[model samples]
Target chain A: MARLVEVDDAADPRLADYRDLRDVGLRRSLEAEHGLFLAEGEKVVRRAVEAGYPPRSFLMAPRWLDGLADVLATSDAPCFVVSESLAEEVTGFHVHRGALASLRRLPLPALDEVLREARTVVVLEDLVDHTNVGAVVRNAAALGVDAVLLAPRCADPLYRRAVKVAMGAVFAMPWTRLSDWYDALPSLSARGFTTVALSLAEDSEDLEAAVAGVDRLALVLGGEGHGLSERWTDTADRRARIAMSRGVEVGVDSLNAAAAAAVACYVARARSAGA
Target chain B: MARLVEVDDAADPRLADYRDLRDVGLRRSLEAEHGLFLAEGEKVVRRAVEAGYPPRSFLMAPRWLDGLADVLATSDAPCFVVSESLAEEVTGFHVHRGALASLRRLPLPALDEVLREARTVVVLEDLVDHTNVGAVVRNAAALGVDAVLLAPRCADPLYRRAVKVAMGAVFAMPWTRLSDWYDALPSLSARGFTTVALSLAEDSEDLEAAVAGVDRLALVLGGEGHGLSERWTDTADRRARIAMSRGVEVGVDSLNAAAAAAVACYVARARSAGA
Candidate 1:
């Protein structure tokens, strides 16, 4: 059973893991140095623990305790109970969902291990937005992509905002970061996966046509502003673009990164099923 | 040529259209009462002006003046010059893009006018998030969606955050609010458009299958939290769902409203092409 500690003071050092939750920069370094990540709200907190991320600690109000009793029962971590106002004071935002868990980070599996049983994969490069990162993971998982490969600079899936936006899909999807960003696509090609980079290149084939005959496939997406690095785009087995309707000259230059991922994943899944 | 007015005070009454822009509630009422909307950044400002939303005024630092000279040359609207600091003081947030334009909100086109030549339409109902609203418009435009119809209670597409997220696609896509929320879907059917509600109903066909043979397609999406209201779901011509991979039941319930819109629009676009 989890130990329940009633705390009136917000300055308790035990609550350090929950401090400055709104400070992305501070939280990033704090989380990295401590090898911990946070899951907010009751559902995501439960999912993280259920996914075998051992809890470093939990912070919540008394009202949330009864609802999360089952989640608390499975761990020996201390639950720092605070008033809702105090919780807000410590976290720098209203604890709207009322429950939060700080969980230990696990070492990501090697690329080979993740690829062993995977036939369809989504490869993301240099995507800096956490929400977009989370959205892609959710879309990839929903459309039956077996694994996700992140380029070295891709936003952290374990970030709290990403975790929330993903609705905890990050806990379920098999993914790992590529250490070798320079050779990521070429290496995937060598592993028998067709690395289809999503771009707007002149000779790029339509997404549906590009995925038609692929047996093992990896869909490569780039970061927000400037798309894939030229090196990665050039090395990919094939280049494909989502068909933007002709004559759309205005703000339709490109679909948002997450939107592109959804269309690409859905089309690839449909074509793969027929193949 | 546009009148150049250099104002040093952040509280200048004429700058009211650009004041407290970070406050959504205030901006909504202010924009509505004055028959105005705002576009920010150089590109979006340029596009909004070029799209013929007559400028009420322009707010920017002197540094932005030269680049936007052509746009300013096109309008007789007052140009307020302020330091970047004062711009932040007036807007309640750092105006990172450095240029803001307050544009006149012309009355939206009637439903019949928007639908006259549109073979593919996207209908949004009660989506509360501005970002999601913008994203859907961007996706719909990119995929050749002819028009977007919003239920009466849907978030305003002309809101600043939505405009920024849409990257000015809000100006490009033809859209208007449905006066009757209850009869919106049925009316589309009456106009010979097959209304496909994106839902998770038990008998909901796969999106691809649902859109396969439709001639005039209207893809309906719901709000962020609840999928769709019962009345809208039951009244639709057909219900369809983006297929989620079976056997993975952890966190993948449905796609984000915008992501779903992207996939649905892409599939419907492809199917319409074949049709």
Candidate 2:
């Protein structure tokens, strides 16, 4: 059973992990330094715990404790019980979700290990928005993608906003950063996975045709502003695109990163089933 | 040509349309009372103007003038030129996008007129998130959906955040609110369209299978929480669901509203093409 600590002070040093939750830059550095990430809401907190992420501590109001009682029973971490108002004061936002858990981030699994048993993968390159990163992860996981690979410059999937947007999918999805950005596509191609980059290149085929009959598939998506870096685009084994509406003057707009990823993942899943 | 008026005071009444944009409730009432909506950024402002929305006014720093010179040349609306600091003070956030425009809200087109030439339509029910509304609009437009219909209580697509996130796709996509939420689906079905609701109901077919071979399709999606309302679910012609990954215990997890909409729209578009 977890020890319940009633905390009345918003500025208490023990609640440091929960401070300034609204400041992205400050929270990013603080979380990185402490090697911890937060999971919010009753469901996300429970999912994180169930996924074997050891909770460093939990902050919640009296009402949230009971909902998370089963999760608390499995951990020895301290639970700081605070009033809702005081919890808001500490976190700089309404704790409407009721409960939050700070969990230690485990070191990422090796790339080969994650890919060994995987036949379908989603690779994201340089996505700066944490929300997009999370949504893509959620889409990939829900649509049966076996794993996710992120370029080093991609936003942190473990960020609070990402975690919240993904509904804690970061906990359920297998994801890790690629140490090598330059040769990432080439190496994946060499590993017998058909690396298909989602781009608007004139030569790119329809997304449906790109993944047809491929045994092992890797769908590569680029950042928000630019589709894919030239090196990655050129190096991939195939380039594919989701065709825009014909006869509509959409004028340079493409589907946002997460939307594109969802469509790509769904199509890939459907095609893979037939294969 | 636009009349350029230099303003030094943030509290000037002429800037009322650009004031306190960060407050949603206040802006909603104010914009509705004035029969106006805001478009932000140089591109959005240009798009809104080109899309035949008469500009009530423009607010921007001096540096943005040249980039938007062509757009201003065609409008007689006043351009309120201010320093970057004043723009921030008036809008309650950094106007990093370089420009903002207040445009007249033309009365929504009649349902029959919007549906006349439409083949694929996306219907949203009570979605409360401005970002999701914008993203869905963008996805629908990019993937070739002919129109979008919103329940009366859905978030405002013309809100500044939605417009910005959609990258101004709201101006390009033909959309309107459904006056009759109760019979909206049945009415579309009567018009020779298939009303497919995206739901997790046990009877829901796979999204691909549900939408296959439909001539005129209406993809009905629900709000962020609790999925579709019971009335909409029961009344829709059919219910379809995106398949969750097999063998993963993603307990009670579903894709976000926008991602789900994107996948559905893409599948509908692809199937429509084949048909």
Number of the top-ranking candidate, with TM-score as the measure: 1
Q: Kindly report which residue stretches of model 1 are placed more than 4 angstroms away from their true locations once superposed.
A: A272-275, B272-275
Off by over 4 Å in 2: A272-275, B272-275
How does model 1 score by TM-score? 0.98
Q: TM-score, each model? A: 0.98, 0.97
Candidate 2 local lDDT, B9-100, one digit each (tens): 98899999999999999999999999999999999999999999999999999999999999999999999999999999999999888899
Weakest lDDT window of 10 consecutive positions for candidate 1 chain B: B246-255
State model 2's lDDT: 0.90
Instruction: Assess each model's interface with DockQ, reporting 2 decimals per model.
Output: 0.70, 0.62
Q: Write the per-residue lDDT of candidate 2 for residues A74-146, one digit (tens) a residue.
A: 9999999999999999999998899999999999998998899999999999999999998888878888888
Using DockQ as the measure, the top candidate is 1
Summarize candidate 1's per-residue lDDT along B217-273 as a digit string, tens digits: 899999997988999999998999887884257567678888989988888887844
lDDT minimum window of 10 residues, candidate 1 chain A: A245-254
Q: How does model 2 score by TM-score?
A: 0.97
Clashes of each: 0, 0
Please give me the DockQ of candidate 2 compared with the native complex: 0.62
Cand 2, B chain, TM: 0.97
